[model samples]
Target: MFPAFAKYRQSFLIGLQSNLVYRMNFAVRGFFSLFHLAVVFILWGAVYSQNESIGGFSFGQTLTYFLVMLVMQFFVGAFNEDYQISEEIRSGLINQFILKPINYFSYRFSIFLAARLVTGALILIPLLVAVPLLKDYLTLPTEAWRFFLLAPAMMLSALIQFSIAYCFGMLTFWFLEIQGFVILSMAIESLLGGQMFPLDLLPAWIFNAAKFLPFYYQTYFPTAIITGRIEFAAAIQGFGIQLIWVLVLLAVNQLLWTRGLRRHTAVGG
Candidate 1:
């Protein structure tokens, strides 16, 4: 167990180093992230200009939700593991992994985790600095416990997102050209994952329907908890739903990987 753990640690270090070498990319992404957040603030500010609240969200609460949503997105978003995996399969690079003792999932996931760690930190610096400037627009949870509860929910959210990406990546085994599928999936996720807006702000029927999907768990549910939109008991129940989604997605990922391995072939040297 120790040796295997060490192997993953090494994989993570390699990933971290590889990503750190491209510091400019992180800077560019951080810039764009801040720009996007500003756009959200302006858009929502306009919406709340006339009203004190909408859908039970005050102006500050809505902005706070977007703030947390942006940070959550930085932590879990922009992963291209699906595209990377598809490319590996298409280029026959996956054959190299078959020759190694490492678990492909663990190795790839370690790399994914490592990249997120570096990027998340890079994004965090500006986010912290922006907090004081944006304090009036931000509405934090009054209950300290809600902040504590957010940790696990965010963890589960990351896992769910990873599993979704991994499953999509595995589709390369069957569909050699999956760029369209990847784009479509990302668009759907962005819309449904509450990256565009808080899910609760949607029509009641739409919000209820979204609960049946995993995308909401990725961004909305966790942000809602941190912003106090989700109370203690509901947050607890939401966490249970998140855990269940993780398990379900993990099973789906495993099934896809096993079946994909059977169909996968190294076409190029």
Candidate 2:
């Protein structure tokens, strides 16, 4: 089994080396995150000044959500995967993967893991340094299970995010351009994934509807679970739904990959 995955291991090493070359970029983004966090605190702070709470999140809990979200985005973000895969498809670079025994998705996923690992580490430093300053406003989980369950939730979120992103990138095998799809997806995800605001804070109908989509499990559910924003029953239900979404998205990804490869090969890709 170890020998079978040697190639992916090599890919991971290469990805780490490549990402290291771009270390300054991650460092700069991490540095700027402090400023962004400051702005968010002030903005949310003002909002809570007028109200005791917004959607059951005290001002501190709200801050904690955004802070946790920023960190989560670093670790699970897959924005570049789509563009990279699309470029490979358009430039005929995907032929290399198809001609080889290696799987394109597996190779890309290895690199994705490396990229997130590096990016997350870099961004995490600044956040950690700033964390002490805001420790007062940050809320820890009251329930012991939440502390235990957070890791698995985050891991599931990573798969859900990557599967969806991989499918988006596979669209390039059919469409010459997928910018519209990516942009539209990003907008919907931002709103639905609790980037713009907590999904629970949305109108009841919208909140209920968004939960049916994969985006809900992405950022909000995992962060909410750790923050105690949800109850134990809800958390358990979310894990089940999260697992289902993973299976569903993986199936979709497999379907897209199979069909997309046939189309590409048919056209001499």
Candidate 3:
């Protein structure tokens, strides 16, 4: 067990180094994210001009929400592994994993985790620097305890999102052309994951329904926890929901991978 753990650690380090070598690409992404945040800032500013608050959030709070949401999205929205897995399946490159002693899921997850660490750091540098400049418009959680709790919530968010993406990638075993599914999954996630806007802005019924879905836990719940939108009791409940979803998704991933592997044949070179 120790040797296997060390091997996985080595893979993670290799992935970190590999991604760092392409730091310029992530730097470009980070730049584009700033532009995206600016556009969101302007748009939200326009919306708040005529109103004091919407969905119990003031303009400053809304701005703060988006800023934090942007960073959370970076960490939780690392889904590229799905596409990579799909492409490898199509190219019959997955055979390499079958011949190795490594657990394919763990191997891929290690790489994904490392890539997120590198890209997350690049993405966060600008946000961290901008925090002081945006201090006046920022609305942080009043209860400092929620801040401490947010780390675990966000980690769960990453794992849940990664599991969802892994399941989508597993579809490649059955359908070699699963790009459409990948795009569809991303579209759904963007819409329902609170990436586009806060779930609080939605109608009560819709918001209530969304809470039951995994998407809500991906972004909105964690943001709400840190922003003090959710009370302590409610935040605990939200964390419970997040944990349950992660377990459910883990089961789904395992089942799908097992079934998919049976159907998968590395036919192409």
Q: Which stretches of candidate 1 lie over 4 Å from their true place?
A: none
Could you tell which candidate, 2 or 3, scores higher by TM-score?
3
Residue 55, candidate 3: alpha-carbon lDDT: 89
lDDT of each: 0.84, 0.87, 0.84
Tens-place lDDT digits, model 3, residues 1-269: 99999989998999899989988988888878788778888899899989988988898888887888888877767647888878877788888888889888888888888988888888877877677778889878678888789899999998887888888889888876777887887788777887788878889999888889999988888888887677888888888899999999999998998898799877754
User: How are the candidates ranked when ordered by lDDT, highest leading?
Assistant: 2, 3, 1
Per-residue lDDT of model 1, residues 51-162, tens digit only: 8889887988888888888888878764677888778778888788888898888888898898888888888877876788898777686788887887888888888888
Candidate 3 local lDDT, residue 228: 69
- Give the Cα error of residue 64 in candidate 1, in Å: 1.1
Candidate no. 2 TM-score: 0.93
What are the runs in model 3 whose C-alpha is more than 4 Å off? Answer: none
Candidate 3 residue pairs in backbone clash:
none
Q: Give the TM-score of candidate 3.
A: 0.94
**How close is each model in CA RMSD to the real structure?**
1.5, 1.8, 1.6
Q: How far out, in Å, is residue 204 in model 1?
A: 1.5
By descending TM-score, how would the candidates be arranged?
1, 3, 2
Cα lDDT for residue 245, candidate 3? 99
